[model samples]
Target: MRTPHVERGATPVNVAGTGGHARRSTVTTHERIDVLLSLPGRSPEVTIDDTDVSERKHPHDEEKGAAKLQQEQSFEESSEETTYVEFEEGDPSNPANFSYARKWAITLAVSFFSLIAASSSAAYALGFPSMTRDLNATQFEATLGLSMWALALALVPLWSTSFSEEFGRQPVYIVSGVGSVLMHLMVALAQNIQTVIIGRFLGGAFGSTAAAMVGGTIADIWAPSERGLPMSVFAIMIMAGPGLGCVASGWIEQNPHLHWRWIQWIHVIFYGIFLVTFPLVMRETRPGVLLKRTAKKLRKKTGNMHYRARVEDQIPSLATLMYISCTRAIYLLLTEPVVAAFSVWAGFAWGILFVLVESIGPAFRSVHNFSTGEVGSVFASMIAGCIVGEFIQIYQEKLYAKYYPTKGPEARLFSACLAAVLFPAGMFIYAWCTFPSVPWIGMAMGIFVIMTSLFNIYVAVFTYLADCYGVFASSALAGQSLSRNLMGAIFPLFSEQMFSKLTYHWGNTLFACIATLMIPIPFALYWKGPAIRARSKFASQVIHK
Candidate 1:
C-alpha cells in the first residue's frame, strides 16, 4: 500500500539518521517519522508518497521535453526498486510462526517479569513506614519513594521503547533486569533517605522496560487476531502486581526483624531470579531486529555488500529514533483523540490503583482497626479481581474472534464497555461501604470489583491501541503510558489528603463521579471508532490491513 502523504504541503527533507552520515539518505522526513512510529517488524512499503514526479526531471534540463520525460521515467523506476527481506513460509525464526506452546511460554515469561517489576511499585509502600523510621524521613519523603518509582516507570519507557524497537525486547529486558536488581540493592543498603529515593528512581527506570517493551513483545509473537489471551495475561500481571506485592510485603513490614531493608532485599532477590530466567525463555522476538540480524548473516556469508533489511535504510539512527519515539508519544497524546481519551481513562484507572496503595493503609486502619499486615493482605482482593478479569478476558477473546471482521477494533472494547459501568459501581461500593457498621469484607469486595474492572480497562487500552495503530501501536501505547503513569504517580501523593479531608465517603465519591463522567469514552469509541479511525492521521491506515 502507498504510504499516505504524511502531512500536506511540505518540501521533502532528508530523513533523520542514527548518526551523522544517515542524514544523506533519499528518504523524506515524513516517511521516516512513519517508520519511527511503527512497531519493529512492520516494514512499511518503502515507496515514496505519490507526490509531484516532475520536480526532479529537469535538474540539468540537458535536453528538451522528450529527454526530460525519459529522465523522469528513469528516476521513478529507480525509486520503486526497493527489495525487502522476509521470513520464508513457516520460518521457525519468525515468532509468529512459533508453536502455540512456545508462544505461551514466552508470553508467561514476559508477564511474570512484568509482574515482579510491577509488584515493586506497591511493595515499597507496605514498607514505607519502616523506611521512614529507619531513615528518619518525613511521611511526604516516604511518599516520594512511591512517586519516584512511578515517575521513572513513566519516563524511562519513553527511552526504552525506542531502544527496544532497535535492539529487540530480550536485550532491553536483560539490561533492565540487571539495572533493576542493582537499584534494589542500592536501596536495601542505603544509609539515608536521599540514597533510598535515588535508588527507587533508578529502580523504576530500569524496571520500566517491562511496562513498555512487553506490548511490543506480545505484538511480535501474536498477530492481532490472536493477541487477546496473551494481552490479558500481561494486563493481569500489571493489575495484580501491586496486590501481590503488598500481599507479601505487608507481612514483611509486620515482622519485627525483616522490615523495609528486607523488603528491598526481597525485591533484589526476585529481580535476580528474573534476570537469570528471562533471557533463557524469551527469544529475540522483534521481527525487524531478527530480520536485520538475518540480513547481516547473509551479507557475511555471501560477501554481498548490498544485502540489507528494509529498516536499515528506512529507520533513523538509534539516538534519533529515541528522540522521535519520545516526542511522537507526546505528539500523539496531544494530537490523537483516541489516544488521549484512552490515556485519560487508563491514567485515572492507574491513579486509582496507586491511591488504593496509599489510602488502604489509612482506611483499613482507621475504620477497621486492621494491622499493617492486615492492610497489606487487603491486596489479595486485587488478585482475586484479576483472576476474574482473566476469565472475562477469555470471554472477550471469544467475542473478538466472533465479531472482529464486522466490528473491527471495536470488538476489543466489550470488556471496556462492561468496565465503564463497573468502575463507578465499584467506587460506590467502596465509598458507601466506609461505615464501621459495614463489614470490612464489603470494602474488600469493592477492591475486588474495582480491580476486576481495572483489568479490563488496562487490557482494552493496550490491545485496542495496538490493534488500531499497527506498527505505530507502541508509540500510541507509550503516549498513553506517559499520561497513565504520571497521573498514577501524582494521584497517590494527594489521595491520602483527599480521602482524609473529604473523608473516605466524599473523597471516593469524588473519584466515582469522575469515573462516571469518563464512562462514555469506550462506548463512544466502540460505536464510532471505525469512522474515527478512518479520519485519524496515524491509526487510519492500520486496522483493515
Candidate 2:
C-alpha cells in the first residue's frame, strides 16, 4: 500500500488545549486520505465500515512513494525555510470575543454618550424665550439656534465618519466629545447670538459622532442573531436623551438666578466628565484594523520577509472609504424602495418631534401659564413613552425568539404597525384638547402617546434595515439619519408659520391625519417584504459570509 503524504498547511495538535481534540498546527496541509486516519484516539489500522481496504491495494507501492518523498525532501532542504503560525480561533483580542458583561458595559457607555449628544441638540429649545430676551433676538432668530444645531447634527457626521476611520474610533469619539465641551463653554459665555449659534453648530458637529457611530460600535461587539435587546436599548437611549435634556434645561431656565446659558455650561461640565473617562474604556473594535495588527505581529515574531497580508487587508485610506460610505448611502436612498418609504415616514416623525420641541414650550406656557421648568416637566411624558416603547420591544423580542426565529425581521415590524395607530391617536388627543379647560395632564398624555409611537416606528425601521442589509448596515443607517435629521431641521422653520395659519387644534389635527395615513405602511411591508426583497437588486443579491 502507498504511504499517505501529509498535505501542506496542516499542523500538529496540542490536544490538551482543546480538551482532547488534536489541534491542527498552521502552515501545513495533508492529503484527504492522510487526514481521515490522523484523527487521534481512533484505531489507526482500522478499515471504514469494516471493509478490507488493506487487501484491495498493491503491497509494492510503498517503495515508489518513499522515492518520491525523498526527492521532495531534497528540494525543500535547498529552499528557504519558512515558519508558520496558526491564528487563534475567535481571538480573545477580537472585540467579538469580549465577554458579554464587558460588551454590555461598552454598550451602556456609548448609550450615555448618545444621550448627551442628542439632548444637547434639543435642550436649548425650551429656553428659547430666555434666549430671545437676553440676546435681543426675534422669536424666529431664537428658533434658528435650535434648527441650526439639528442641521449640524444631520450634515456633519458624513465628515465625522471619515475622521473616525482615519484616526481610529476612540480618538474620534474622545476628540468629538471634547469639542462639544469647548463649544458648550462658548455658548455659555456668548455675548451675541452669532457666537452662541457658532457654538451650537460646533457643539452639534462634534456630538454628531455619538449619533453616527454608536450603532457601528454596537455592531462591532454583537452578532446579528444576538443584537436585538442591546440595540433596542441603545436606540431607546438615543431617542430619550434629547427629551431628558429638555426637561433639565426647562427647569434651569425657569430659575431666576439661572439662565439659558447655564444649560450649556451644565452640559459642558457633564460631557467633560465623559470625555475624560471615554479613553480608559473605549477599545479598538474594527476587524480590518485588528486583523492588520495581527498580521504585523506575526511578521515581527516569525522574522519572515515575505510575510504580508493583502493591501485590502488593512483599513483602507480615509478618503476612499468615506467616499464609498457616503456614495453608497446616497445610492441606497435613491434606489431602495423600503429605504425610501421608511426614510420618509421616519423623517416625518422626526420633523414632528422637533416641531414639538420648538412649539410645545410656547403652547404650555402661553396656554396653561406654566413656568419654563413646568413646561420642561411636560416632556417627561415623552420619556414615559420611551419606557413604554422599550417594554413593547422586549415583548416583541420574546415573540421573535419563540415563534419566528427563522423570520424574526418580519416579527420586528409589530412595533411599526403599533406606532402607526398610537401616533395618530396621540395627535388627535393633543389637537382637540388644546384649550386651557383641558387638564395639562391630558396634553402630557398626548405627548407620551406620540413619543411611544415614534419610538416604536423608529426602532422597528432601524432594526429592519440593519437586519435586511448585513454588511451594508452603516450605509443604510446613514441614509435614514440624513433624511430624518434634514426633516428635523426643516420642520421647525415652518412650525410657527403653520400654527399662525391654522389654529393649534387644526394644526395638530393635520399632524395626526398624516401619522394615521402611515399606519398601514409597516403592515403592508411585513406581509409583502419577502417578495420585495426577492426582487431587489441590492438586497437579495449581496450575501454575507
Candidate 3:
C-alpha cells in the first residue's frame, strides 16, 4: 500500500497502519513530526518518522510544504472567525494617518466652527446699548445676556460631550449647527428682552458643541508629538474670535441703519454658510464610532452576529453614559491636583480676558474719550499679541521636542513659566499706564502683553492635560472649560462695578496681585509634576505606560 502522504505542519490525516487506533504525524523542516494519536487525554508528542517516509522528498520540499500548510491554516481560521476591522498603523482610513492636507482641512473647518461659537458670546457685548435702548432694559439686565450665554456655554458641554462620545461627532455638529442657526434667527426677530436673552442662551448652548468637541477631534487626528502647530492655530482661532467679533460688532452697532438686530442677523448669515458647508466637508473622525459602524455593516452583509467592534462591548446606555460624563469633570476637578491647579490658573486667566472685553469700552472712554468703535479697536492689540504668542509657541514646540524624553509632559510648560511672570507684569503696566499723559500705545502694549501671556497659558494647560491624561483628556479639559466659562460668566457681571468703585488703576492692580500669587504654579508643576503623578493611581497608570 502507498504510504499516506502527510503535509508538513498541518493537522495531518490519519493513517490506517497504526493498529485500530489512528495516528497522524505532521512533519517539520528538522524532520520532526508532531503526532496526535486517538488515545484519550494524551498530549501531542514530537518524534522523527523517518523510518516510514519515502527517500524521494528533498530538504527544500519540506520547507515549501510547511509554508503552504501555514498559509492554508491561516486562511481557514480567518474564514471561520469573525474579524473586526481596524486601522492598521498606516491606514488611510485612520484620521491620524490621513494626508497632511486633509487633516488641516478638517482642523480649519472645526476651528472655524469654534470661532463662530466663541465669537457669538462676546459679540453680544458690543450691542449692549442698542439692546438696552430697544427693549428698555437696564445695563445690568442687558449684561445678563452675556452672562446667560456664558453660563450655557459652560453647562451644555457637560451633556453635549456625552452625546458626541455616544453618537459620534458628526451628528452632534450637525444638530448643534442647525440649532445655532435657528436660535440666531430667534434672537434676530425677537421683540422683547426675555426672548433675546433666551435665544442667546440657547444659541450658546448649541454652539458650545463646536468648542467642546474640536479639541477631542484634534486629539483624534494628531499624535501628541505633532499636535503643537495645529493646536496653536486652533488656539489662535479660539482667542482671536472674541477680539475679532468685538471689532466687527462695534462697527455693526455703530452703524445707524444696521443697529443691534443686525448683529444676530449677521451671525445667522455666517452660521447659515457653515450649516451648508459643514455637512459636506466634515467626515466622522472618531475611531471607535467608525469601527462600530464598520462592524455593523460587516455583520449585516455576512449575517454574522459574532462580528463586533471592541467599543461595542464597552458602550453603556445613553442615560448612564450621560450621567457619568456630566459628573466626571466635577469629580476630576475635586480629586486631581494637576487638573485642579491648571483649571484655577486657566479659569482666572480666562476671566481676566472676558473682564477686559467687558471693561475695555468704559476703561478707554473714561481715560481717552474714545468712541465705541474705537474702544473696540483696542482689542486689536490683544489679537496682535496672540499672533506673537503663536510664534513663541512654535519655539516652545521645538523645546518640547528636544526635552520631552527627559522632562516628560512637563516639557510643554517651558513657555508657561515665562507667561506666569508676564501676566502680572502686564497687569501692573496696564494699571499704572492708563493715565491721559501715558500714550495710548502704552496701554495697548500692556493689553498686548497680557494677551500674549494668556495665549501661552491656554496652550500649555490644554497640551499638558492632553499629554497626561491620554484617553481621559476630554474629561480633564471639560473640567478646565467649566471653570473658565463659569469664571468668565461671573467676572464680567462684577467687573463694571469693580472698575466703577476702584477705577482701572487699582482694580487692575488687584488683578495683578492675584496673578502674581499664582506665578509659582507652573514652576511647581515643572519640578514636582512627575512625583505627584507617580503617587496618583490614574496618573501613574498613564505615566508608566
Highest-lDDT candidate: 1
Q: Quote the RMSD, in angstroms, for model 3.
A: 11.7
Identify the runs in model 3 with alpha carbons over 4 angstroms from their true place. Answer: 1-82, 88-91
TM-score of 3: 0.83
lDDT per residue (tens digit) for residues 350-440 in model 2: 9999999999988887778998889889988889999998999888777766755656467768778888889899999988878999988
For model 2, the local distance difference test gives 0.75
Question: What is candidate 3's local distance difference test score?
Answer: 0.79
Model 3: which residue pairs collide? none
Instruction: Give all candidates' CA lDDT scores.
Output: 0.81, 0.75, 0.79
lDDT of 1 by residue, 1-545 (tens): 11112233322222122110111223332243343443244344445433344444765543454465676667754443322345555667777777888899899998888898999988998887788898999877888889998899889888777776588777888888888889999999999999988999999898888777776788788976677668777888887898999999989999999998998899888887887777677788877787677666655765644445656756778898888889989999999999999999999998998888878887888999999999988999999999999999889988988998899888989999999999999999999989899999999999999999999898888778978998888789889999999998899888777776899989998999999999999999998998888999999878473
- Is candidate 2 or 3 superior in lDDT? 3
Better of 1 and 3 by lDDT: 1
Error of 1 at 312 (Å): 1.1
Regions more than 4 Å wrong, model 1: 1-85, 543-545
> Ranking under lDDT, best-scoring first?
1, 3, 2
Tens digits of lDDT, candidate 3, 237-294? 8888888888888888888898789988888888888888887767787877776776
lDDT of 1 at 208: 88
